[model samples]
Every structure is written in structure tokens, then in C-alpha cells.
Target: MTKKSRRTHSPAFKAKVALAAVKGDKTLAELAQLFDVHPNQITLWKNQLLEGAAGVFG
Candidate 1:
């Protein structure tokens, strides 16, 4: 059996996923499956995106 390797996601990819999460177009589980990442990771990125969005205006 082969071991699963750790994957490193780029900022753009994370942003895309986070944006999708923000859009509410798909459920967290769906996003996780689509992005090949954990639901929690997507949520974290989504929250980070939201938290930092204010910086753009500030």
C-alpha cells in the first residue's frame, strides 16, 4: 500500500476554494470533495478570506 502524500495548495487555489465557500454554491463537504481537501481546511480559508476582506477597504 502506498502512503498518501501531503499536498501544498497555492494561495490562488485557496482563494478560489474560499470564494466558492463564500458564494454558498456548494456545501462544505461538497467543496472538500471537489477540492480534495478537508472540510475544515476550506472553512478555515473561507474565514480567513472574510477576515482579511476588510483590509481591502481599510
Candidate 2:
């Protein structure tokens, strides 16, 4: 069997995912399924977004 290559997500794409997570309209699992990514990945992006949020005004 051939091994599938891992895909690298772009910054813009990550930001989009992070934004969606922050919106809180959908569950992490739903976002993960919609984006074809793992739920942990979305959670990580959300954490990054929250961490960076404080920098906007500082």
C-alpha cells in the first residue's frame, strides 16, 4: 500500500478555521468534518487564535 503524504495548512486557511471555531456555532467535530481535518488540529488553531487575540491591542 502507498503511504499518503501529509498536507500542510496555509496561514490563511488556519485563520479561517480558527475564526470558525471562535464563532461557536458548530462543534469541533463538525468543523473538523467540514474542513476535512482532525478535531485536535482545529482545537490547536483555536488555542493559537485565543493566544494571539491579546496581541491585537497590546
Candidate 3:
């Protein structure tokens, strides 16, 4: 059996998905399916966005 190819997503895409997660309009599972990524990844990006949001104020 062949291994599935790994995919790389752009920062803009990650930010968009993470922003959607922050919006609270969809569940992690839903976002995962919609973005074709793992739920944990979505959570990670969301946390990153939150952690870095303070930079915008500086």
C-alpha cells in the first residue's frame, strides 16, 4: 500500500481557518472536514492567533 501524500497549507489559509474557529460558528470536527486538516491543527492555529493578537495593538 502506498502512503498518503502530506499536504502543506499556506499561512493565509491557516489564518482563515483559525479565524473561522474563533468565530464559533462551526465545531472543530466540522472545521477539520471543511479544511481537510486535523482538529488538533485547527486548535493549534487558533491558539497561535490568540497568542499573537496582542501584537496587533503594539
Using TM-score as the measure, the top candidate is 2
lDDT of 1: 0.96
Candidate 1 TM-score, C-alpha based: 0.89
TM-score of 2: 0.93
TM-score versus the correct structure, for each prediction: 0.89, 0.93, 0.91
Q: Residue by residue across 1-58, what tens digits does model 3's lDDT show?
A: 9999989999999999999999999999999999899999999999999999999999
* RMSD of every prediction: 1.4, 0.8, 0.9
Weakest ten-residue segment in model 1 by summed lDDT? 28-37
- lDDT of candidate model 3 versus the reference: 0.97
Q: What's the CA error at residue 35 for candidate 2, in Å?
A: 0.6
Judging by TM-score, tell me the better candidate of 1 and 2.
2
lDDT of candidate 3 at residue 23, scale 0 to 100:
100
